[model samples]
Target: MKRLMLDGPGALRWEDAPEPTLDAPAQALVRPVALATCDLDPAVLQGRFPLAGPYPFGHEGVAEVVAVGEEVRTVRPGDKVVVPFQISCGACGPCLRGNTGNCAAHPLMSSFGLGPLGGLDWGGLWADLTRIPHADAMLVKLPDGIDPITVASASDNIPDAYRAVAPQLAAYPGAEVLVLGGPAAPSIGLYAAGLAVALGASRAVYLDTDPERLSIAAKLGAEPIEGAPAERVGRFPIVVEAAGGSKALIAAVRATANDGWCTSVSVQAKDTALPMLEMYSRCCTFHTGRAHARPSIPHVLDLVATGRFDPSPVTTRTVPLADSIDALLEGPVKLVATN
Candidate 1:
């Protein structure tokens, strides 16, 4: 088997590895049909958030089940599925409460492409084959007609965008949403903008310097603003900070309305001080955590199946799965690599 391995900062390559298999009663073996890079992949490859050398490298994918273990009843061989980024047992207490990202049955960072974290260690999914533990709990079956590109990022970004804005909209229908988008996790912010409009937000405003991202947001029905995030006006009730910098977070916090909610998906490699006093003054309900993708994937898929949310437009580049490592280093907004 071949998998993408990060040798060091700004280094990536395909490495030979043992073939993955159904190692447990609830596991399954899958052949990745399509793979997408997460917000962290580029940084990891670029040496921004440095990790140990030669670690397995990707986390998002849509795959075809090639084999299944005895207890896997929810899906069968030949079914195409979306594998959530987090590994969790559905029976765990935290999982039952919709907090599947930190399942008690799995160690911290118990996920694919995240190497050696003291658990049933799995390698990257950007390989010829991969293993899926607790398949019944971890996999979401794709609808019959859904395109792989359409649901490729559902394992993380799509569902994440759903969670970030859904609750706030539920609390305040037609609420305003503000997104600070940049190089890191641009799709997340773009997705949030599209979802806000679809869910009846009074206004969805996207602030970014990238013309490509701003255009995508505009096409998605959001009002795109081109400038620095700090150069903003009034406050918004719902905000998503995904630009991945201290300034972006600061700007997001400053632009949030009093008693508003902000969801930040940026993986801050280093600790940076925030304006705690300002957030305190606004009574802001700020949230920053790993996305619990499994619990919300089905709903996101339903939205895709019913023609409400389409992730296809976000994919601006496509390449063979074998060339993923090189494509990633090139750094396109939403690149999909298929088998």
Candidate 2:
């Protein structure tokens, strides 16, 4: 078997590796059908993000179950499923509470694809085959008629976007959403904007300086603002900070309406500035963390199945898995590599 390995920034190569087997009763072996890059992958590949390398290279994907252990009942051979990037045991305390990203059964960052941060050699989806533990808990079987390419990002970014607004929109029905997008990984911000509209936001306004992203957001049914956000953007009840910059983060935090929720999906490697006084005065809630992807994937899939949320528009292009290395290094807004 062969797997894509990231030697370092801008340094990706294919290397031979032993095929993964179903080593546990709760495990399953899958053949990736469609694979997508996580929001930070492009940055990591270009050396824009600081994560070190020498790890298997991919995390988001939908796959076909080729084999399953005796204990895996939820899915069987030939079933198509979405694989969450994070590793977790369903029986663990954190997983029971829906915090699968922080599952206690493994190290804090146990997951796929990510190098040192991923915490284990669980392998990457870019390979011809991969092993999935806690199969019943981690795999979300794709609904009938759903294309694997459309929901390939359900493994991570889509749900990461879904989490930014779903709960807040539910809390404040018909409220507006504001997304501050930037050059750094625009897909999450775009997804959030689109999902806000699909999930019943009265208005989903996307602010970004990039014309391409603004146009995509508009096509996704959001009102696009083609520039940076001001100190506040009309007090949106649901605000998402997907633009990976301190200034954008501050603007996103300040834009939260009184009692509103602002979620930052950007990976802030260092302590950054925020409008503490403004946030305090507004009494807003600020949330920033790695998404607990498993719990949110079902809802995202349901949305895709019902024709409510379409992730295809966000996908800049789809390439054969054989060409994934070059396509990934080139880094479009969202790229899907199929087997």
Candidate 3:
């Protein structure tokens, strides 16, 4: 099998690898039908995250069950399923609480592309076929009537966006929601904003320096605000920082209203300063972490399947698995791999 391997910063290669098999009684072998890049992949490839060097390089995808382990019953061969980015055992304490990203039972658990969690580095989904542990717990079968292309991004970005906004929905119904950044973040933000509106947001404002991204936001029915931090602050009740840049984080913090919530989806590798006093004075709530993708995949899929959410407009391109690196580093919107 040929898989995408990280060679170095800004470098990707297609290399031959061993084909995956049913590794455990609860595991399954899935051949990817559609795969896409997450917003953090480029940063991880550039050595921007805490971990470094060539590993498997993708996390988002929809796959067909090629083979299943003995214990797996809910899914079988030929089932088209949405695979979440994280590797988790559904019975873990954290998973039971809906925090699958922090599942306690899956020791050393991590996705195919990312490095191992507790010293077990594994390859990612950018391959001909990959092994999925605890298949029943990890894969979500796609609902009927959903386009594979449209829901490909839901494997990560869309659900991530949904999680970024979930915590804020109850506290700020019909409040103005601000999204910061471009690319995946803004794209996810747009989906989230649409969800917010459907759930009753008064308005959704998206800010980004990229005109093209802002244009996409506008197409999603969000008010596009063009400018930098200084030009766009103090306007939204709930601000989401998806840009992964310090400046964007600052903007989200400043733009949020007093007693508001700022959910940051960017994976910041370095330390950043925050307006603690200002946040304290304003009673602002700051939240940031890896998105609990597994738990949210079902809800996101439902939204896409029912036509309540459409991410096809945000899918900028589809490339073969061989061009994974270039597609990831250069695409404007979501990039799906059809291999």
Output the lDDT of residue 211, model 1: 94
lDDT of 3 at 32: 83
TM-score of each: 0.95, 0.98, 0.91
Cα RMSD (angstroms) for every candidate in the order listed: 1.7, 1.1, 2.3
Model 3 Cα lDDT, one tens digit per residue, 1-339: 888776656777888888877667999998888887776665555556555656666778898999998899889999999988787889978888988887787554466676543223546777888888879998999887876777787777888788767668766667888887654355676666666655566788777778777777777767878876445645677888877667777878888898888888776667889989999999999998777788888888876777666677677788776665666767456778786
- As for lDDT, the candidate ahead, 1 or 2, is 2
User: What's the C-alpha lDDT at position 89 in model 3?
Assistant: 89
**Candidate 3 residue pairs in clash (backbone atoms < 3 Å):** 56-113, 112-123, 112-124, 113-124, 174-202, 234-255
- Model 1: pairs clashing at backbone N, Cα or C within 3 Å: none
Tell me the number of clashing residue pairs for each predicted model: 0, 0, 6
Model 1 agreement with the true structure over 1-339: per-residue lDDT tens digits: 888787766788887888976668999998889888876777666777656666787778899999999989999999999999888899989999999988898777688776564233677778788888889988999998899877888888888888899889999999999988887778888888888887789999999999999989988889999987676857999999889888888888889999999888787767878889989999999999788889888888887788887777677789998766668888788888999
Per-residue CA lDDT of candidate 2, range 1-339, in tens? 989999888899999999988778999999999999888899988888888878998999999999999988999999999999999888889999999999999899889999898964788889989999889989999999999999999999998999999999888989999999876658999999999999999999999888889989999999998777554558788899988778878888878889889999988877887878888898889999999999999999999899998878899989999888888889899999999
The lDDT per prediction is 0.84, 0.90, 0.75
Error of 1 at 280 (Å): 3.1
